[model samples]
Target: MEWIKLIGILIILVGFIFKFDTIAVVIIAAFTTALVSGISITEFFTLLGEAFVKNRIVTIFLLTLPMIGISERFGLRQQAVILIEKMKGLTTGRFITLYALIRQLAGLFGIRLSAQPQFVRPIVNPMAQAAANARYGKISEADEEIIKAKSAANENFANFFAQNTFAASAGVLLISGTLTSLGYEVQATSIVLVALIIAGISFVLIAIDNFLFDLKMDRKYGKKSSKGGQKS
Candidate 1:
């Protein structure tokens, strides 16, 4: 039975690596392992149901996907582009960097700036596309998609990594809980202060990266303009 459980975990990892649908892979793996371990199909399904009920948060988020899909289909991207274009002096990297900071600030108040259909697809993506177009004159569809993905990743890294700095953050509570469980007394404030230092360093690094990217883009645009002047 233990071997069956191990096999199920292995199958799940392999399925993830092979890019299979996660829910399908997990369900199939669970049922197969249960059968191999001499558990009846009815028992296996009951276990699955119990697990689902225990993790109802995951289920609720899954159910929200359809509403998100509907919103995205209703010209959300177009609206974001229009909103961004009206803002003066916005560059793609700068725009995303600002969003990163805002997301981190929002996290301080326990508000999650989610990526999916919430902020990324509907808001940040189109804003990024508009910025790309403003900076480069035109952007390819592939490049637009890349910008959207990069913007989302920036938000995730910034918000998640930065929020650990707050002493009362969920990360602090988690760390404190784990330490207590393991018979170690740790101060949440100390952990949070160290996390703040780490987050500060990360912010500096991201800022430098954005600055370099902007410099490169400026050089590219300058060379293109110089060549165009020669042609004229």
Candidate 2:
């Protein structure tokens, strides 16, 4: 009977292995776990409601999506493309590296943003594509997708590694709390210093990656068209 309480884990594993609907699989696992744990259906719903209420702030990101959608509908992406096309001597790699640096700076300042929907998809990705198009005349579909992926990767790399540079950031606070609970004294400032070092390394690595990306693109595609012979 006790072993039956672990059924939820088995269910979740099977669902993931078989590629079932993710949300449904998770919900089913929760319900099954609650039932086996002797939680009544009413009690289960109550617990779910309580958990949702406690974590409702996590859903705040959803509110930004509609605003982003409205702006995109009104040619936000097109404006970004135009802006990038107008910039002389800005190559795709240089632009992406610059954006990653900006992302890290924003994180250091505790300026949280929905990078993918708000920045990358609407601004960065299109701008990178425009920079490529400006230099190459017209890039292949595959090349455009590669640029999109690199844009997203830059956002992720900078945001994840640099957030702790803010002494009051969640990662800094968590590290401090965990160390204190383990009978060790820790300072958020110390955590931030380490985070800064990690962030610097990440910036260097991303810059190198961008340089390699530019070289690869140059090799795969021909030199910049004579009309727009700008070095990346």
Q: What's the TM-score of every candidate structure?
A: 0.74, 0.79
Q: Tens digits of per-residue lDDT for model 1 on 1-232?
A: 3665567888898999999999899888888788888899999889988998998876666655787777778977777888887776677778877877777667656675456557776778788878766556665677667676777788777876777777787888999889989999999888887877777777677667666766665555432232223111
Question: Cα miss at 72, model 1 (Å)?
Answer: 1.8
- Which residue pairs collide, candidate 2? none
Cα lDDT tens digits, model 2, 1-232, are 7999999999999999999999899889999999999999999999999999999999888898998999999999999999998987788999999999999999999998889988998889999999888767778898888899999999999999999999988889999999999999999999999999999999999999999988787776656755656444
Q: Where does model 2 exceed 4 Å of error? A: 33-38, 65-67, 180-184, 208-232
In order, what is each prediction's RMSD in angstroms? 4.6, 3.4
| Best-matching candidate per TM-score | 2
Best by lDDT: 2
Minimal lDDT window, size 10, model 2: 223-232
What TM value does model 2 have?
0.79
